[model samples]
Target: MSEANAPRVRVLVADDHPVYREGVSRAIKARPEFELIAEAEDGRRALELVQELNPDVAVLDVQMPGLQGNDVLHAIKRDGLPTRVVLLSAHLDSETVYRAVASGAGAYLSKESSRERICDAIAAVARGEVVLSAEVQAGLASEIQIRERDQRPALTPREHEILVLTANGHSAPDIGKQLHLSQSTVKTHLKSLYEKLAVNDRAAAVAEAMRRGLLE
Candidate 1:
């Protein structure tokens, strides 16, 4: 295959973490079939880059101080950019995961597994497939079953704990350490929780949980 014709998966990396954002940029640049077209440190900037670059894919972090990845996802869809968005985030709970997916992200990929996983996910989303951690997919399934059983959530013990942490703005790794589970496990539970709650993202989850009096 000739170099120029190699699918040329140009990308935008959006994250506040210099290390992660740089790493993602480098990872794509190092590969033959991929290109790092631009980088953004926050949602506002990400939007600008998307408009200016119109990359094939956007690899974004879920939480930015402002204008989060979800907002970017909406913008990409709203403005009809040819770009597809893949969320490369630290694990959010099942609830957050469900919301991320529901928000129309092309793919949801965890930062913990992103070294190789991000590339794989971007490639898949470039091909028009939704993607997430394997654990996330299973957790969504289980959460659905539970919601059906009760017509509401009967959060597993771990989910109950995660719900509280999520409310407090604790990152997935923090919740995982507190709960003695891996970060991915915490994210899985959160993804399921978000689905059961019928919410689409963290702010909504926190607001809904607060309204329901589920956390302090």
Candidate 2:
């Protein structure tokens, strides 16, 4: 298609901050190849508009009230929506980056990103490309390194069951009863679980298991 006749990228701008949202809306409007289709003040509204409008791109704040940006992104993925999500956040922690990427956000950019950069990300994501700001990239790298450093050993099926039961605050005897195993076998599994998780106590084991995503 000729540049002039090409369809403008349908865009949704969502942020809790009115000034920032308006600025982004204005920037999208100023772009000849883009169309500002909707604005939302929170993640819930953002997701509602995405479902209702089916815009090609959604610019979302990562830390909005109600649902978070990643929450909306996950919803879009769950529903098989074609709308691409671009997450903007002032916080660039490693955990945040990991969650955003894992949840399938098309773009993750810093709130400090320029309007042009944010718009560029929207355009890139609309074309099904992944975009990440330098800060976000660094955060992701940190998260990867942290995960590698703290990699947990693979849990046996029995150990996994024990861990799940333990997370639910089940006593050793209770877990044994539920699994139809002897108390001695339960203690043995608990010992193995503690060793594998590198923790001394049940509470620490549970915390480490959760941190490693071993307990879901």
Candidate 3:
């Protein structure tokens, strides 16, 4: 069908990683069936641009600097944006998969999925079909198994990063400056990490996190 005759799919991409975002944009542009309307590097921008663009579909990264993919999805719902969301991520657990499924996302795609798979995901979401990549499915299964075997403190990727920095003798202010967290936020994380790692000092906390594989 002609581009006009066929249903045109407008897409918005939201990813914090610049390389992945650009790769996705390039992949979409190389396809004939999809038109990429705008690009966003963070969750807030994603939500804002989606509202402005009113694209037919939005490809969102699950872990962003603020307002994660699901949070952005909620914002879209709250604002009644016309865009349908397709969550893209490098990692997600079974609980997260089910949660995203329940959160009105149109699709879930792992970043490791093939280029053709991405295009298919976009097309499927535009058609109101929910897509799940094979890698995403497998990762969810593996994550569930690991979760079942775990009875320890769970920290976010950013939190884990902070834990590592603090262990290396960085003060809260220094950690905040490096990771873009506030001083109070850095201290809060340090306190939480100390408690979680069962350490009384920064060195102890770092050692514990490293021992537990929470940090490199």
Model 1 residue runs over 4 Å out of place are: 1-4, 146-216
Candidate 3 per-residue C-alpha lDDT over 1-216 given as tens digits, one digit per residue, 9 for 90 to 100: 765689679989999999988998999999888888899999999888987879999899999987799899988887877788899887766778867876788889888877788888899888889887776677667765676448457887777888777767888898989989899988887788788777787888877776776664
Runs of candidate 2 with Cα error greater than 4 angstroms are 152-216
Better of 1 and 2 by lDDT: 2
How far does residue 202 in candidate 1 sit from its true spot (Å)? 39
Candidate 2 lDDT, 37-131, residue by residue in tens: 99999999999999999999999998999999999999999999999899999999889889888888888999999999999998899889999
Per-residue lDDT value at 155 in model 3: 84
| Candidate scoring better on lDDT of 1 and 3 | 3
Regions more than 4 Å wrong, model 3:
1-4, 138-216
TM-score of 3: 0.62
lDDT of 3: 0.83
Using TM-score as the measure, the top candidate is 2
Highest-scoring model, lDDT: 2
User: How does candidate 2 score on lDDT?
Assistant: 0.92
Which lDDT tens digits does candidate 1 get at residues 132-197? 787678776766665545554577777778888888889888888887999888878888888978
